[model samples]
Target: MVEFTDIGDVPSAEVDRMRAVYQPLADSVRELVDATIRTEMDADTVAAVRAEIDAATARLRSRQIDGAFGVRYTTGGDSLAWGNPVIGVRNPIAPPLTIERDLEDARGRVFTDFHLGAAYEGPPGHVHGGVAALILDHVLGEVAAHADTPRFTGTITLRYLRTTRLGRLHAEAAITRTDGIKAYAVGHLADEDGVTVEAEGVFIQPRWARG
Candidate 1:
């Protein structure tokens, strides 16, 4: 990863306010995605809905940002990774995760709670295996960051233990070992029944951070 300076911070209240506005927008878009994929509407109805969607899309694009939204933080120590594609609150494809650190109890462990809706469907009733890997990679990478040993994901290997159902899911990761700048981590994703996927990864702390 290229070295970049921090973007500084915004007030927590401002961050919360922005989240309140955009989070609901993301939810609405997610609903649109789910409906688009699973709708049983007839041809005419589908056409009508597409027309409305196109209109809405045009309105939103009327004024647009030039590029992607990146992570930001506040001087008060509040950080928002809300623009992340996998877990970002403003992204419809995201699982919209709320991750927590278990720094005191498990040290390097991190856990995330999220839901997978119909938009993530694969194999009729289960989430796409690739989506599972995306979630794992983010959480496993965050595990290193939470431990104050941040790194970019070098490689990730996932074992789909079983089909992950379309519903509430939990994931957890912790650093298992380290060799030089490489941090090895392992984790799993589970639903109400049990774990459906397992993952292991090596994350590399940049040479800049090591110094």
Candidate 2:
């Protein structure tokens, strides 16, 4: 297994340099996803492109270490979760979330900025409802996990107030209340105009976690 370390222990300078190098690669992958979804190539050309992509994927895969990229920290105290589904550096499926967290407040607040592409479409030019729910679940879970109180989702409820447009979008989440082992959180997804979806969730610290 590949041993993991948190980025927290890494030198700030090294972390900055690594981010500068890897971020552009991540952005390029993101653009590739967009291009793949929007391309209008003919069948034979598409097949050729797919074969080339497969070759590239195979090459990268061969160079990668085995297993998932678990969270890791360097000896210098910098932590990195480079494979995180929402903001992973190497995960091509993620929407490249730039999540911001407010750590000072008792009820933690989390926000993310991202753009949805054709792969996320539902009704015509709008984003899929399930995709919105997935984003809310992640943000709400983060609110529950903020400040080291990591909790697992016990229940979630989502209300689709409107069709979310497939473009730049904002999401926000905050812990609403907590009672004993359970934490309640509220979250929303919005476009430039206003809120499109709202969510409420309950999270529980597993029994082993309390010990």
Candidate 3:
């Protein structure tokens, strides 16, 4: 699905306003998801809350865009992909990673510091391997993509060293090299203790961009 709408060159102030409006909503929804899992409320109360939630969902659906909110960029180069699954400000499913670029490095290095709570668990008390892949894939892809040669993942390989605890974690990636239309990158996901998952991937720029 895709969001087919034009959000013209919105100014930075307007972008901040948009974030103010939607990020909070996503925060509340994210909290609700967490609460829904841990809540020990009475059955009656749970049913009542479910009813209210249903009503709220209906109200929101009453007036909405047609498809997924796709990435939009400003003339200044700022981007808003608020519905993205990993970092979308408007998506509760996201850990909502906060990625930072290392300007001093020449590899287009990027890192994210994020936390995963009860909602992202796979094993008894650990985060899912797939979740780690999802984060690393996006991070690696970000580094592999160049301004002149936007790319897509061609292959990704991951190594699970140990179980990732569901808590604060750090991850980063940097492009190692590029060959014509392809870029290669490496990254890892880690907890306070040490690295838990490492990844390497190749991202290829589409042929259309070669011209």
Candidate 4:
């Protein structure tokens, strides 16, 4: 479902300032995730690092929200989806796809080029099938939302052709057809070899929009 909170009172300047301050921390946390997976330090060093991590975690928890981060909008009509798992700039777990709106022959297309590092591996050197599904769902949802009225994912099907390797990858989704309040779209995940997974999804207008 689409959610955008109004931060009309908070100066846009402060919003940008907070984002600039925290985004790099998220980037470092992502690097920390990769390092945690590959580190080969001595037991003492690991313990020392863990202590520092614990202290940092405690400090961060001292002033934190009790719920998931919600989408916020700026006065200039910009949305900040900073907590979204697929593309949240503030989320350390995101492959962080920056989907773009491109039209081919006058059809709306949403595409993103991203990378999956060590933290996302499920099968040795390949990306997890579930992760691929997650990417497609979000990508397809973007396409579904770009039409006259926004939509939410109703159902999605994915077909795995070959293993998706962990490296630079591409994904795109485009609406093929629509019926009433429904939209159908197709997309895929690809490596240099070609499409590794194919996806199609059914999206429907929210109940509020349906009426």
> Which stretches of model 4 miss by more than 4 angstroms?
1-3, 9-12, 103-105
What digit string (tens of lDDT, one per residue) describes model 2 on residues 1-211? 2345444555779888987887677778878888898999899999998999899878877877677778777776666777776777756667867789877876789899898888789999999898898889989998887434558889999999999999999999999989988899999999988999999999998776675
lDDT digits (tens) for residues 23-107 of candidate 4: 9989999999999999999999999999999999999999998678888876766678899999999999997889888855455
Off by over 4 Å in 3: 1-6
- Candidate 2 lDDT at 80 equals 73
Top candidate, metric TM-score: 3
TM-score against truth, every candidate? 0.89, 0.86, 0.94, 0.93
Instruction: Tell me the tens digit of each residue's lDDT in model 1 across 5-105.
Output: 35566677887898899899998998888878878989999999889989999999999766767665566776566668777888887768888888595
* Model 4 worst lDDT window (10 residues): 1-10
As for candidate 3, its clashing pairs are none
TM-score: the better of candidates 1 and 4: 4
Residue pairs of candidate 1 with colliding backbone atoms = 9-73, 9-74, 10-74
Stretches of candidate 1 off by over 4 Å are: 1-9, 147-149
In Å, residue 186's CA in model 1 sits off its true spot by 0.9
Better of 3 and 4 by TM-score: 3
